[model samples]
Target: MGILVQEDKGLFHLQSAGMSYILQLVNDYPAHVYWGKKLRSGSNLEGLLNLGGNRGLDRLPQEYPQYGTGDFRTPAYQVRLEDGTRITELKYSGYRVVEGKPSLPGLPSVYVESAQEAQTLELTLKDDYAKLSVILRYTVFEHTNVITRSVEFTNAGETQLRLQRALSASVDFSSGDMDMIYLAGAWSREGNLTRRRLVQGGTTIGSRRGMSSHQLNPFAALVKPETDENHGEAYGFSLVYSGGFEAEAEVDSFGMTRFTMGLNSFDFAWLLEPGEQFQTPEVVMVYSSEGIGEMSRTYHRLYRTRLCRGLYRDKERPILVNNWEATYFNFDADKLESIAAEGAKLGIELFVLDDGWFGKRDADNSSLGDWVEDLRKLPGGLSDVAQRVNNLGLQFGLWFEPEMISPDSELYRKHPDWCLHVPGRRRSEARWQLVLDYTREDVRQYIYESLSRIFSTVPISYVKWDMNRCLTEIGSAELPSERQGETAHRYVLGLYELLERITSEFPHILFESCCSGGGRFDPGMLHYMPQTWTSDDTDAVERLKIQYGTSLVYPVSSIGAHVSAVPNHQVGRITPLSFRGDVAMSGNFGYELDLTKFTDEEKELVKEQVANYKQIRSLVQQGNLYRLQSPFEGNETAWMFVSDDQREALVYYFRVMAVPHPPRRSLKLNGLNPELDYILEASGEVYGGDRLMQAGLALPDIQQDFVSGCYKLKVQE
Candidate 1:
């Protein structure tokens, strides 16, 4: 489960628990040999590199193909030399293997707690005439069938160079007979599963919104045409970046496919001076021979433990009650207190005062960048209100859109050029807000200082860092004209910097990232913020698909799901409270509605829901997930969570719109110990694990629309 080098044959084999990736230096050019099931030790890997015979560079499966160098496919990178030529060749110069994975500079990547857990391979390629050196890094962990890849480019020459397109990683498959699956949607409908067969041309998915747009995620998977959740081979690619990104799957004339993922080259360029270097973000690749389910579990575990950090990474998230949907911009100190008091009576642990607490901000159109408390709403200020909420035996949280500015704000009035803009053009507006030019050091410093001030005095326990809009009129005021194209990427880097400072300073605060809900719910944000608001659409019927699709790449712990009032604020669907609670409990459970407005009967039901969640949240947050049915395939959705020791499990099933005169159905569970006997907690019925898995457990008759059920199982000792 480590890297093996056949130095004589110029072959490098990176092996994980269940997969292997082999590449060979053929004539000083690295060519991909095999990437699939693990091969036996001392396998004839050299012969595999020559299986297709001596072919042109265009046809060979290259580890990192170049443009204008015999190969005609998309280059892994393109650089504009001093002489204005975009052609360059990189030949093998040297290589080294290390015991630990090295962190990428100023970037967020999966980390290793100990050096013995993973092995890294650094292969150096040099363009002698251009004086360019590129280092391709690959790391394989001992316990997972996952390999991460990234690239670093250094200008070793005395002359300056320009990087036009620098993608992180690429892979070529021998055959194009596969299906490409990705997550796509917009706003409230984020993370909808979309799958299509590979064609002769290229199929691309990306985000150019200066943020990882909700329209498409920075992830994709390719599987055989016959692959399903439980069977067949699947190769997954995910970019560990939050800004504009592109993932492409290209099929050539001879039925060969090449997949690439990294920063979007659109309006992107970097200037590398002599002795300077540029490091691209990391791309995580997973090879799952057991199917898409296994691939998803690999990603979920890796990101949940290694990528997400801080105090809350492994802890069970508190059941929070956010006041955004309840009061919006109209809440006063009294209104917030009432909600907190009612939530405390029920089992909610945290009360979040969302939006409208700053400046004269009565609505979304004003007072974004101004962080001062609105004294008119709270006569004593934020400290007083936070103390009042804390006195109710609940933790207090605040919401901030630190990266946005309202045109009517004092900060914007003082510095009109603070927002992203072009000199001659009128700035565009979304949600009546403009994105702050984070590329400017002054802007980031001001935001940091402003947030730090509040963090020091407010006794705040959690923060909802919200960005309501995307980047527009993308020009930074501090950058020179020649570096204007670097605005978007620089902005992302600045965001990471600010996040690192703020999160590090206040390590105890639980931060959740939101972009009008689920817009920026990528792995990059999860590095600093452990969880993300799954979506703005709190309708249980809608969340059935949203949560289900999100589980493909993100862990259940990283999803912030909430029970909102009905008709839901976004979808206006009138779903039952129990149905909403069942759906929301699958994630970091919370409530987004006004608890003070609940009737006595409703209050009792909420209490029960909260208690039940408290009992099972540990298993839900850290257990292995097994999806039995997909909402995309039918009206019914079923999923389960199993403890690591296989002694306990939780099963949830939902019927969106119950069919009339439906046939009896039973769900077959997975990830259970077939050798043990289990007891159902609710009915006290005993059944063997083999019977529950093979013969299945009968589902109850739910005749109403939007109904759900939960079953808990414990192994009989």
Candidate 2:
């Protein structure tokens, strides 16, 4: 649970709750020794650095390898000197141990409330010829098997240096016999878990699309082939970054695997003047001996409590109903109020007026940067509608895409150079809008002032911050020629600054981030906004896989799930209302349909669904999740949440499509106190915890497609 420095043997051991990460300086080069199950202090760790004689740098497990060196795999960093050479070697200089984690300047990272929560090790390496000093930072949590790594580069030389590649962290594993698992999908179908065997070559997953594109997530995991939900070893690496990122696993001919992750070096170069420093975003690493589930739970707890901040960090999220899918751009004040009225009757706690509320935005092409309300739609502006919804006993929320500007908008017309584009280059647009040049302080200031005016005037309780497009031209108007490659990373940094200002100024507002749904759903955004619209695809069947795969890394509390109208807006799949409610309840419950159109029977069912979710919302949000079955495997999907005390449990089971003459099945639960007796609320049957976990409970024999069931278990009194 602390960092140990064995200077005599040049070994540094960082031990967390269930794992140990040991590294050593061999011949003045830091080399990875071991990272796995915990090892006792004073053990013979030196023998673990078993690099054989003929110690070629290529075969050594380096803590941070460099290019042009004998290693020659993927360098953690690369710098071009003033002499125009890309060759440099760094040697271990000094190191220090700190009591608490230090925040990365101008970046979002996992934070600590107290000094006792974690310990950080700062190891310094110096390329004396280039006068560049690299400080590698590693922090280990005292209570979780989580280690975060980041790197800081300082230009100590008299002349400027161009950094061609400066990745955050890298690790080398002795064995490449593992399976690579990553989340891959696009748009409505985000977070599809994909796995493959690690081959004897470079395997990479990343986003060159500016925002952490929905095409791929900034995460990857390596696991033993036998690893499943509950057993075997797994190592997870997730970048706390939102922009372009590259994660690679290179298996060398020697069977060693080198895993690296950081800002994508593609079209990226930072010019560091003398005495200037550049800090890379942190990469969170988790290790588990009890398989992928334990690794996920470790990340879940750490991220939920530490990474995400503000008023909503520990509070229960409101049951919100957003009007996007219900009315789109056709809604006026009257229509919005009517929707809010019906939502209030159904016990919805918040009403979100998503997109198309401002500046002639009847469609996505216009009025993106203009924050003023359209007089034609709302005669009295946002105040009128916010108050109207508030009168209906619902908290009011508004949507804004502050990072984009439409060509037809006043902001863009006044300052055409404000968007990301190279001079004389044709600007490309997506979703009928161009990405704002967030690298400029003036642009960020204007956006801040615009939103601040509304927040000050309106009674807004929530904000759905959306970015509908990715960076295309990848050039900032204000950056110099040498720094043009820095635009993509600078845009992300500027966005973080704006987000920090807005969220800090309005701490009471619950901020939910969206990038046309799950496109920018990464840890960096979660630091300012507590939750994210998991995906725009609200179809219960599609969400079964989306939410299940997302739960592998994100906590349930940070997932924004909603029950939309059927024929679901995205997929047009007509599913039962009850089934929709069952699936959406597993996350922060919400509705995304026109409630006024519901039938009388459907209204009653909606009321019951709301009530049921209210009774178990706390358990679902904060409880430990145990996945029993995966939708990826077959027709059935099952998962459950167990309270910390193990006295209360809520189980959800879904049958996507009914099978003809199916064999009887029972769900065996996990994370239960095996010695206790429990009462199943659904059937009024009492059973022993051991029996429920071992023998299992019989699933209902319903012969209907898209059918679902929810059960509550309470310890018998």
Deviation from truth (RMSD, Å), model 2: 0.8
* Model 1 segments more than 4 A misplaced: none
Q: Which lDDT values do the candidates have, in the order given? A: 0.93, 0.93
> How accurate locally is residue 119 in candidate 1, as Cα lDDT from 0 to 100?
98
In model 2, pairs of residues that clash are: none
Candidate 1 global lDDT: 0.93
The worst-scoring run of ten residues by lDDT in candidate 1 lies at 45-54
lDDT of 1 by residue, 550-594 (tens): 999999999999999988888778999999999999999999989
Error of 2 at 384 (Å): 1.1
TM-score of each: 0.99, 0.99
lDDT for 173 in candidate 1 is: 94
* lDDT for each residue of candidate 2 in 283-356, tens digit (9 for 90 to 100): 99999999898888888888899999998998889999999999999988999999999989989899999988
